[model samples]
Target chain A: MTKKRLTPPLTDADIENLEIGDQVLITGTIYTARDAAHKRLVELLDEGKELPVDLKGQIIYYVGPTPAKPGQVIGSAGPTTSYRMDPYAPKLLAIGLKAMIGKGSRSQEVKDAMKKYKGCYLAAVGGAAALIAKSIKKAEVIAYPELGPEAIRKLEVEDFPAIVVNDCKGGDLYEEGVKKYQK
Target chain B: MREISVEKITRTVRDLCIEAACDLPQDVENLLRQAKEREESQFGRYSLEKIIENVELARQDTVPMCQDTGLAVIFVEIGQDVYIAGGNLVDAINEGVRQGYTDGYLRKSVVEDPVFNRKNTGDNTPAVIHTEIVPGDKLKIMVLPKGAGSENMGALKMLKPADGLKGVKEFVLKTVAEAGGNPCPPIVVGVGIGGTMEKATLLAKKALARKAGEHHPDPKYKELELELLEKINKLGIGPQGFGGRVTALAVHIESYPTHIATLPVAVNLNCHAARHKEAIL
Candidate 1:
């Protein structure tokens, strides 16, 4: 598999050629949200109320990270399971939300949205939070402070590593990879 | 009777919580190494390497091993002759939980209400404590910080005696297969067979606290563990569900004598970072 470097505010061209199993190192700004934050974001959309941040062509990382100790930029930060966000992903992707970094599989609706919206799903190593935190250079809670760690935070990252799990072309590494190795 | 101070239990619980949260258990770590050596898929192998590296970073830096530090599940085995002095036992444990989550900077994932309010408790408190009275005067405390990732995927089933061993096996395999990558592969499958519904689930969870890679004392359950482990790895879920030959590191089954007609089975899964730390006072 080919390795590629990416920056956020991604365009269709930035992800169209990416296939499942391709390794990527993302550098730039990405937003953080978990199941709780996604619910609020979607609620705002349904009410026609503007969201706190523009999601267009941006990436969302599913994480709620441990509290950072003194002198640390962030604490252990890794991807949470992605399926819980499936109910809300199609709506976000419809609004130009680009890639998502998380672990586990997504629902069929999410896969369809990725295909239609020119977005892809990336999988970071689950439980590799401390290692993942090393790539995050800065973090701030831009919205929903009441949600505690579930609050929406903007993070600046450098070479944040992940692998393409689902792609715009409907390729799924989970399905293909399992079939290849199943005895 | 030996009198043990509440202060000592609190201090011990606090330290155990931090230790379990940050350090991947040594036995589980060794199993991952073996899994890595045998992995045929390049992606699976690469994923394993990163996990190994992350475990080291967290331990060396005294940081949480994962972002979801998880809820503290404490198992306390107190000797029948030991008298807990100075304070109520439950209160002392919660106090310890508050301190450990705070001092360790572990994430507070617990909610004040499961259905409503949904507010963070600020400090992780009221750990799920399971206490048993044992035969000796010593008190043993074990903390397993269980993450929601794997815990959410657990399942329980009640089968007729007719279903027997075959049905139980089918249900377990199905649970793990459907769980797939969600629980995080290279998982430990903890099975509880027999007992009532709640009892079975408790047994399943407690089974996870058992040291990884050790078989049940009974020969029948021990054989079942080995067979299930082989079947699970063959499913090709692999490391991170990327597909490989090492989907599960161990399968531990804890069983109890059952009623004549009912066989209840429960499954609890722990991610590759299967962590548990204990202290005996």
Candidate 2:
């Protein structure tokens, strides 16, 4: 059976070119949200409220950062686990969200959405907050500061490293890698 | 009976929490370097490198090792002869956590309620504290700053007494296998066997505080720990589950006697960055 390679999500090809095991430094815009922000985002879609930012071809990072130190753009910033946001992700993808960034596994429903919508999910190193924070040149909370760490922020990153856990072509590094190495 | 002051214990605990968050323990640091050398997969090697960099950055800059900085969880062993002077012991411990988090510039992740009105407490207060009474005059405190990434994957099950050793092994492997790369591969497996449900969970958490690579005193349990570690690595969960032979840095299991009819088991996964520090007062 012939399969079409899906359209890539980012303005830059680095994210698109990222292999399952290859490390790529990412730059450009990525949005941030956690459990609370995700709930509000889906609610906005239900009420048809205007989204704070247009997600078309945009990546969303699941992170809740510590407060920044003096002269720092942001505090220790690292990705949280992706599973908590799995339930709301496909809905966001259906409406044009292009990418998701976090650590750990995403649900099959979210992976299917990636295939259907031509989106991708990336995994950043889980506990490397300070190193990940260095990639963020700019950060501004776009919504829900009341949620503190869980607030949604827009980050401008440079050469941020991540693994392609799920790609638009339905390739999942987690399962494939496990199967390849399992004895 | 020996008398212990609440203020002294609280002050010591407060320092330990901050220290644990800012400085990756020496043993954990050495292990990461070792894991890097032992990692055959290129991605696994890369992950280990990044982890070492994170540790350096955290120590030099006084930033948290992880964004989660985790909920401040404490395990205390107090001698029956000791007394917490000047105030309630639990309250003092909570105050210590509040000051430690605030002064450390750590993220406040805890909320006032689990369900409605999940409002941030601002200071990361009201810590989850567990106290055990032992026969002695000393106080020992273990602080584990548990990240949500791995904690979300924790599980507990009640097996029939007949399930025995094989059942325990199966439950642990299944849990780790299901976790895949999500718990930040090269994870620490903490297994608690025997005891009631809550006791089992607490035991699993306490097991994590044992120095990495250390095993239980019982020969049977030590063998079980080694076996579980080998089986988990065989899952090929690898570092970050990208594919390698080093899925687990160590497997530490703690057990207690239980009712003849019950076999309660709890498994807690700790990410490679097992941020913990201890102090005795």
Candidate 3:
């Protein structure tokens, strides 16, 4: 339950320090990607092609935000479920993806990769879109503009709040948390 | 002996789409509040509190409660004595969805095709419209924007009639447990029992459209709903499965008669955001 602050271009020590259930407020730049974009990124990687953006020591937020209104920075922008991206996560982690911000439990494969690759998985409040969007000061599609919501966007965030779900040490709040409260 | 224009329906549907996405209904809000008060885990309480804050923000501003503004699913009950004027009902509804998503700045989550070409329709169009012919001279339209986080976790199973009520309870619990945090905890579970396979799934969807925390009119069903709610909360999935009590806000069930050999059950999970709005014309 301890609260921490993070500014990305995170280091190995940063990933190793986060534990399950600790609250962290993130600031600085994070990239956004949905499943479709993940597919393309991994496909590019498989073919030994360079990525559109540098992901080393960066966070990728799994979201497909609603379009912003006339005077807004972004629309309702909450985390989507993480499991769908599990197939691509290990590959991204292998390539130095430091952390992921999403909702829901991820597969064991993703968790194992996190442990091995010094990555972490964070969970934002799933349906708290407007609240989450408040932290995002700027967003622009860095890649795949044709993908609409699924488009990869570079975001400048300020105090974006999330909790560590899967840390580098193989801690999973979804498992331990439920076990503690299960009747 | 009454006529309603498709243009009017379109306008109503469009407004409903925006309203449903931005506003968390009172009953649902109350349930979330209750869950927050009851939640023991620090993480669970924090999540519930944050969700409530998000709900208020959505209500006060022109913002959606969730970014996954979801597939536009419409339910219409048209009176037999009513004449529809101007245009095709389905097309009008889709047009409404298109206008609402565009004007409202909601995400267009619909895909043109499920397979082979997984492409977004870009307008959140061709809504899943379910129509029913009723007895009165009025038409009712209900719009629910179903997010895939919970919708993807839905399951339907055809059990042998011999499995009985015990079987139904077990299957429903299994579905929820297997779903884990994927559907988002503090969910609203809609259980549909009996009828054909598709009918059961449809019934489950209809059950979700029912007011959250409202009991079935039938005493037997109401008791079952209560029982299921208690059991689900006991599972300790909590809010967001960060874990503690209050895994679900409600368990609303609808049932219909089925074939002698079949006892089909479907579970439709709705996240805490569960957005729906309606109008009577």
Tell me the DockQ of each model, to 2 decimals: 0.90, 0.74, 0.91
Model 3 lDDT tens row, A1-183:
899999999999998888888899999999999899999999999999999988999999999999999989888899999999999999999999999999999999999999999999999999999999999999999899999999999999999999999999988999998898888
Q: Candidate 1's residue-wise lDDT over A113-177, tens digit each?
A: 99999999999999999999999999999999888889999999999999999999999999999
Top candidate, metric DockQ: 3
Task: Write candidate 1's Cα lDDT for B30-54 as tens digits.
Answer: 9999999999999999999999999
- lDDT for position B24 in model 1: 87
TM-score of chain A of each: 0.99, 0.89, 0.99
DockQ metric, candidate 3: 0.91
What CAPRI grade goes to candidate 2? medium
Interface RMSD of 2: 1.0
TM-score of candidate 2 to 2 decimals = 0.94
> Which portions of model 3 miss their true places by more than 4 Å?
none
Q: In order, what is each prediction's RMSD in angstroms?
A: 0.7, 3.2, 0.7
Which ten residues in a row are the worst by lDDT in model 2 chain A?
A1-10
How many angstroms is residue B51 displaced in model 3 relative to the true structure, after the best TM-score fit?
A: 0.4
Tens digits of per-residue lDDT for model 2, A89-180: 99999988877889787788998988787778888888889889998999999888888988889888877878777877778887887787
List interface RMSDs for the candidates, in order: 0.6, 1.0, 0.6
